[model samples]
Target: MRLRLKGARVVDPGSIDDYKDIIIFDGMIEAVIDPSSPYPPVMLDSSDPSSVTKGLKSEENDTNYSEAGKIGVDNFPVEEGDTNYSEKGKVEASPTVSGEGYTNCSKEADITEIDLAGMVVVPGLIDMHVHLREPGQEYKETIETGLKAAARGGFTAVCPMPNTNPVNDNAQITAFMVNRAKSLGGTRLYPVGAITRGLKGENLAEYGDMKQAGIVAITDDGRPVENARVMRRAMEYARGLGIPVISHAEDLSLAGDGSMNEGIVATRLGIKGIPNAAESTVVMRDIALAELTGARLHIAHVSCEESVDAIRQGKKRGVNVTAETAPHYFTITDEAVAEYDTNAKMNPPLRTEQDRLAVIEGLSDGTLDIIATDHAPHSLLEKDVEFDRAAFGIVGLETALGLSLQLVNNGSLTFDELIEKMSKKPAALLNINNDIVPGNPADLTIIDPDAFWSVNPETFFSKGRNTPFAGYHLRGEVYMTMVQGTIAYHRTDGGQ
Candidate 1:
């Protein structure tokens, strides 16, 4: 079907001040035309109560095209001066205007002509950090279930972490995950290989073979590689294969018996604390290793001002490094642990307010490349345990976009900048095509920036309901998500 989306304010981050109407056909964009351009000879009818246009037929050749035809102006409003305007002694105009000489055609085009007033159309988001626990931990999160949540969250593609019960360290497991996500799940999945055998941080995993099997990157998330020699060797091997070694920076020696961030909040709560040095020390070490080996290194879930300072200084030098921080780290602080809420207890635990502000500053000043959810799902039974013994992650697949818009709506960042950080920058970092043009894949997200709604965990698509923002009101919800030209998710709450 040919879809002529008229009068859409397209937001393309690749260009400056670029907004135009677009035409999509055969699952790909055909043209970016002006809003007032003439309609094609054949157009679909949008007047019917049903939204979809029915029966593709010719409109110009039929003399009775104005007889409530399905193809020509089914219910399009007649222009002004089109109703019985007589030129002195000319024939009287019909009750309705015909298609002839309709220069300034009605803003209405067809059912296929989607009106995008007050909306921003951006390239679909790509999350380089996700944990779709399949092949072993289906109860926690399967490929199909995780992709559904990703679609609702407006992510067109995601890179799954390799930390399952049987870790994805071999080509066979990576190939199986790729095929399962492609055939069963709707969202695009890029499998990440393990940095070490079984994530034990002793023996290096098959970096060369995994890259050959089409893995985008390698990392042992939730388990940092503590051995300097092993991590350095892994980095050099990954560099040889042209893939980045994403590091979950942490020094277990500093994090001894600690469950949360080290600060006044932890002291007041009488809980063990993990000092900020634990993360910053690893960041400093990784930067030195990257410099020594000349390999691409990426830091994940970077928190605290020290880590940011280390990354900033490394970039100032010539070391090839990139980093991403989760939304929780930027919005929440260690003070949230005052109530002993395990949902707020995440790895690289939330730091002080000063550190949170540092993360925001890093993102705004371009020191941070992307914002990911780190969307790890845990069952309710596992999360409802004692605060100290409970899990260390939260469900964020469905709330990442809403929380991001809150930042923009509150004057922290611009709309175009948010889109770039969420969609284009991550794609470029992971070496993927950021397509938002004609003949490109129909991967796009439609967002209503002004829409306001409160988050409810019961309404989440993921089985995990361990989010801290559950009753918090947020603005800017995703109205529709399209993957490969197919409607993957559509809001039914009329929030749009």
Candidate 2:
């Protein structure tokens, strides 16, 4: 099948940024064509509905295409006098060849064309951190539900943590996850294997076996590897296998059963608090380990000013360390917990206003490499409890982009930088290619930058509805997401 996505602004970070047409064939991008090139003629059969050009517009409209069979660039009838000429936008009656921006499709071939006049096309977003509770904890989320939510959120791929009930510690569990996601068929899933067996922080898992079974990275996500020696061995082993060791950087003793950030908010509420040192101290240790072992280390969900500075300084010393932070860390502060809102609670809990600013600065200055959603889903049984007893996370996959777009809106990062952090950088880290180039998989996201919508958890595709941003208005929406040349999700109501 041949698909021509016409007249959309193609924003593929450093590669391309212009109004162009994308040609997709058989689940791959066949070509990126400049709309200004007039070599390929618009071929259309007025009698055939499917062959009619889509996105028709008057000459007053600057857009070059039309909706399904009217006068437009891809398919317009060339009349005798009023507007038809050979040198102009007229197509040859029967040209059977291909040119710079044109392909002559045979009558037997099926061609589907969509006119995306005002949309922006980018590489599909990838979330390096998400929790899809399958294999054991299906009540909270399944592979189907989590993948659907990721697709609707414009993520083409997601890396699920290995914190399932049984934990993905071996080849059997890793293969089960990979096969399940493949069978479901939507957003791609790359499982991150457990670093320590059972996340116990003692015995290291079989990195070679898990990597063979298809784990992209290794991490003891929900539980930190408390033993420095164990973590160092894990990093060294992962380095030999050429996979990054993702760290859940938190000192359990320092965190000490805290429910939220250790600050005035927790103090006033009389709740247990987790101080900044709880996370930064571990982060510093991991960086030192990475430096000593010559291993790639990625710090997950960095939430404080001290951790950001640590990572920045590590990079300065030429340490092989990379880090990520979630949107909630920068968008909101510990103050969101002022009313004892359990939904606002998360591990390495939201920090102070100063910490939030530091995170934004880290991202702007390239200290942080990726913006991943630690999309943990929980049932009401875990979330409806008291503040200190509530679950430590909120469903983030659906709200990540909307919240992260605030950075661009506030001039904290450029549009290109945001796309790089969300799509390009993550793909590079995971060793996947999601660029909008010919021969690459047609995994793309179409966005409506001005589309305004309220954060309604009821409308979310994820099973979990726990969110701190519910009812908050956000701009920039995922208009449609395409994976492997197939439309996985399309926003129905357009915009709220």
Candidate 3:
């Protein structure tokens, strides 16, 4: 099928223009043309409606920590006077003309036209760290459900952490996860194999075999490696295999029984606290190891000022290191955990306002290389418990982009910079390129940057319904998500 995406803003460098028409065919971008160029006037007939208007108005600084609604089906809210998805605004593309129409070398009626007026379109976003919870915890999430959440959040590709029951330490499990995602038909899944056997952090796993089975990186996530010698060896092996080593960066002894940031808030609540040093100390250690091993090291979920300083310094020292931060770290702080809120209880937990400002500075000064969701998902049963005893994550796949755009809203990052952090930089980390030019896969995320919406977890597509941003009014929403020229997700205001 062929499609014409018209009137959308494209800020990704090499995507053709500030505003242009994108012609996609045969699972690839066929052309990026000037809007005024010779072509049929783009139109939307009973379109999905998601791309039409900027969404509801709300504050990004909302601080409520209440639990969101119970998970619901279809979940997405329906606007008044909408039609069925399958029947409305279907892309009636003709198979005969194929790629010719996209090049402006032939007639235009051969392909479907999707009018994306008043919308923002960019190269599909990518997240290097996420937990799809498959292979063992299917009750919490599967490749199918998790990718749907990624699509709704405007991501085209995601790398899932290998912290499952059996762990992805072997090639067979790695291949199984990748193959499963392929069969599910949504976001591209890049599996991260365990750095050690069963993530026990003693013996190195089959890195070479896992890389051959589609594992792009290696990490013993959910828990940090306690053995320095073992971690160095894992890095050495990963360097030889041409895969990056991702470090979780936590000192368990320092973080013992800690549920939230070790700060005034934790003391006020009388709960155990995990100090910023718990994360920064490990970041510093890993940076030193990466320097010695000459291996690529990526610090996951960096949350404090100390860690940012460490990462910034490492870059200056010419160490092969990169770092990422989640939306919550920048959007909310440890103070948000005032009500014994479990949703905000993530590992490398949220920090103080001072630390949050530092993260923003890092994002602007290039100290941070990527903005990943760390899209951890946990079931309601796992979360609806005492804050100190509950799981340590909240679902992030759906809110990632909108929440990240808060940076743009506050001038910490420009729109183009935001797109880069969300797309290009992450893709570069994976040693891949998704430039929006001809002959490239049609991996695209079309968004209504002005579209406003509430953080209602009930409408989420993933099995997990926990979110710290729930009840906050936020701007930005995904209009359509395309994977390899096929519609992986379309917000139906009314059909396929």
Q: Which structure among the candidates has the greatest lDDT?
A: 2
TM-score of each: 0.85, 0.88, 0.85
Error of 1 at 368 (Å): 1.0
Q: For each of the candidates, give the backbone clash count.
A: 0, 11, 10
lDDT of 3 by residue, 171-260 (tens): 999999989988888789999999989889889999999999999999999989989999999999999988899999999999999999
Runs in model 1 lying further than 4 Å from the true structure = 16-18, 39-111
Error of 2 at 391 (Å): 1.2
Per-residue lDDT, model 3, residue 97, is 19
Residue 473 local lDDT, model 1:
88
For candidate 2, write residues 1-496 as lDDT tens digits: 7888988999999878888788888899876766543213344454543322222211333223222112333323334462433323233222332232222344323457778888899999999999999989899999999999999899999999999979999999999999998998889999999999999988999999999999999999999999999998999899999999999999999999899999898899999999999999999999999999999999999999999999999999999989999999999999999888888989989999999999999999999999999999998999998999998988998888888887998899999999999999999988999988878999999988888889999888898988899998998888889999999988886563
User: 318, model 2: CA deviation in Å?
Assistant: 0.7
RMSD (Å) per prediction: 8.2, 6.8, 13.3
Worst 10-residue lDDT window for candidate 2 reads 50-59
CA error at residue 130 for candidate 2, angstroms: 0.2
- For model 2, what is the error of residue 180's alpha carbon versus the real structure, in angstroms, after optimal superposition? 0.9
Identify the superior model by TM-score, candidate 1 or candidate 2.
2
Clashes of 1: 0
